[model samples]
Target: MDYQLIWVLLIAFAVFAYVTLDGFDLGIGILFPFEKKQENRGKMMNAIAPIWDGNETWLVLGGGGLYATFPEAYSLLMTAFYIPVIVMLLALVFRGVAFEFRFKSRDHTNHWDFAFAAGSIIAAAMQGAMLGAFIEGINIKDGHFIGGAFDWISPFSIFCASAVVVGYALLGAGWLIMKVDGPLQGKLRAIAKPAVIWMAANLAVVSLMTTYLNPAYGDRWFSTPNIYYLAPIPIVTVGLMFWLWHAVKRREKTVFGITLSVFFLSYLGFGITLFPHIVPPVISFRDAASPDNSLSFMLVGAVIFLPVILGYTAYAYYVFRGKIDDAGYH
Candidate 1:
């Protein structure tokens, strides 16, 4: 149980890292429709061009870690979310292709831009849907997935998809607030105002939906003793949202930090809401986790290489600091 808990925590941390790091880049792509100028678009791409590839490492880490540590959980999740997962991978491929092709063609730049932005939207939406479906729970029988193909498709998942899109947009807007300035930055600040508002609204809706739609989660949250541990999450989230609103309005550089804080807080709330059980309710992570020897072996490689990954990510960002104004590569 101890090792299982550790492995799950490791995988969860990887997930948060991927969502926080790659999320903004995807958000930048989501912002494509608003910008008409080619140069501005170029700069947008340039801003993320250096570390974009590295940002994807966290996805691999998270997915790979889950598969390694909790094979059963990973297997059931994959079987249930087969289509959405495949679609997300395809969209990510398009985003990568657009990154290269958009730079190569002058006449077809807008065409590639559309592809890039659309890919971001598709990837982000699918991820959100997957998350919502995960929270809603998968159909399990005899410790295996018994649900049909469309089980993940639902209205709640659709709303979650929208929430994820808005969330990524807010993250991207906040990121831009740090990296660029002038008219473009001003516009981002303005855009961020509504993005913040919508994000808060989405958070509210999703929180309500979780408690209403999933009685297990609702009972877990609303019941006594548990609420004492859980109350701080919502309280802190409200405070951060208010602070984020103030930062955006004041045109403070702290928007980026606050945005990251919001993401962290949201992730924290999610973890607290669903813990001990990787699949929720009946199936504990301990039941799904791999044997101790296998987990230990996997954890060894994970711990050894994590620092290297973080170091590389940090160095890449450091080398590419400052506002991007051109299409030049680092």
Candidate 2:
């Protein structure tokens, strides 16, 4: 109902969209070398090539929205996580260049593939580390970063990094299952099973760690009214996970869609739990937001531009629909 709350929800939605849409392609890059065959790698690249660049628009919207609507939170976050942010930017550049060049330069395809995979892994790891650090909360004094930059690399951060890798791998496997068929689909199915199991285990560990590290979250999850309402989210998530496992085992075409839904729901839960708190105890949504005039002005542009972006993205995917055949590449 509050304008500040609306901004928070919009930014959260943008972040979740970026993670869900681009996540599979990043996962595909992480799983690239595991395929061990040139043909399979090409197929995997083709599956994501059409929409990967467009998927990153959500990231731009999320980050830009934060800067415009929550300037203080943005400033503090950027200062605290400067090094990791640079690393993520570089990784994104590497991955984007490798994606295009790998197709153009046949002789350097191997080199580009290496770049792509490394970029993807590094980017995913940095993002997970950032998330872990944010959840753990940063050390700020008088609205300034008061800790070392490397403070982000704790055991929990390491666990989060590994979880992201597994998460991406699951998405990659799911994409493969959806886009390719025959032998490749079989191979992807084999890969998806273990990947899902690892993801489930990692999720359990993260959940436990979050609750143990922050007793407040325990209250959020277990105390009275919120628990009853929020209980269904995790329950549905677990059900979806089981359903994804079954679909993968059966080599069902809808496995990718189901796995993505599971991811979306999990993100929804996280977003809900963290609502109205842009930076946990340090900053509430109302305090973090820019002036009301700035927000109102931004809202005007967002109304017209957001729908256009969404429409073009949908059209691009629709135009490129169906499997990536050998002839599709140029």
Candidate 3:
């Protein structure tokens, strides 16, 4: 009956899907500079080639779902973070182009490679900064964003952006560890070792900073009654961090799964920080949702289409489930 809450969870699911799916491809781009060998780079590209485009389907779903289900929040978010949104979109476009063209040209491969890496970095950074800006809260008055254009740029946003880059790279390294073997996999193990360390450090800093910046968040976690329920999240997170380190060192395939759990926990903490609030600190899901009639209508479509999308996505991964070699996926 709570259409508003349902829609919020749907949107959240879509965003998380996008992060987990598209993350590794963007991460591959982030890790490109570290590996200068074209043969290995080709292998890396080959690893994600089939699924990269499909991974972005969740992004479209999330963005469109927000507009349909939470028009007010979408409007305000677009207006408030227009610059970063545009930059992120453009970067994704450029990255896609690089992905397609890099394989086509022999002589200009390096240029396309650089574009892909740069685009991935820029897109990931903008996404992280936008998240930071959203978390820090937006300036709204009488339901309208009243902040200046550059309000999204700040030390916290920059720090968050840097953290996301490292996080994505970590995801990418774990992915490579799973998809490739031999020296490439070994190199990714090295990359993932340091990447996980930095990611863990960043996660700790960001968690502390988030609480320090918002006293309500501090109370939500550390306050007596709430603390009891929330304590297990951080404890499990620490355990997973150790597991991830061990997995990397042992070249275990579970490395990616462990890394994903860490991201999922971070995402869960973020949701906890802003529960019910789509625009955060100002507007809530109930405040932003469409009319009941509209929600009901869309819900019908979502129900019908959601399974199809999931089915196809699962099939694609299943079909390409084989590992990548110098020759490509097999």
Q: Which candidate tops lDDT? A: 3
Candidate 1: residue 118 lDDT (0-100): 94
Q: How much lDDT does each candidate structure score?
A: 0.87, 0.84, 0.92
* Prediction-by-prediction clash tally: 0, 0, 0
The sequence of per-residue lDDT tens digits that candidate 2 reaches over residues 72-131 is 999988987899999998999999999999989999889999999999999999999988
Query: Model 2: which ten-residue window has the lowest total lDDT?
Result: 321-330
* Better by lDDT, candidate 3 or 2: 3
Among the numbered candidates, top TM-score falls to 3
In the range 1-330, model 3's lDDT, one tens digit per residue, is 877888889999999999988998899999999999999999999989999999999999999999999999999999999999999999999999999999999899999999999999999999999988988999999999999999999999999999999999999998888898898889889888888889898899889889987788898899999999999998999999989988998865799889899999999999998887899796989999999989989999999999999999999999988899977788
Candidate 1 local accuracy as lDDT? 0.87
Per-residue error (Å), model 2, residue 304 = 0.3
Model 2 lDDT at residue 72 = 91
Extract clashing residue pairs from model 3. Answer: none
Q: After superposition, how far is residue 124 of candidate 3 from its true place, in Å?
A: 0.4
Give model 1's TM-score versus the native structure: 0.96
Off by over 4 Å in 2: none
TM-score of 2: 0.96
* TM-score to native of every candidate shown: 0.96, 0.96, 0.99
Clashing pairs in 1: none
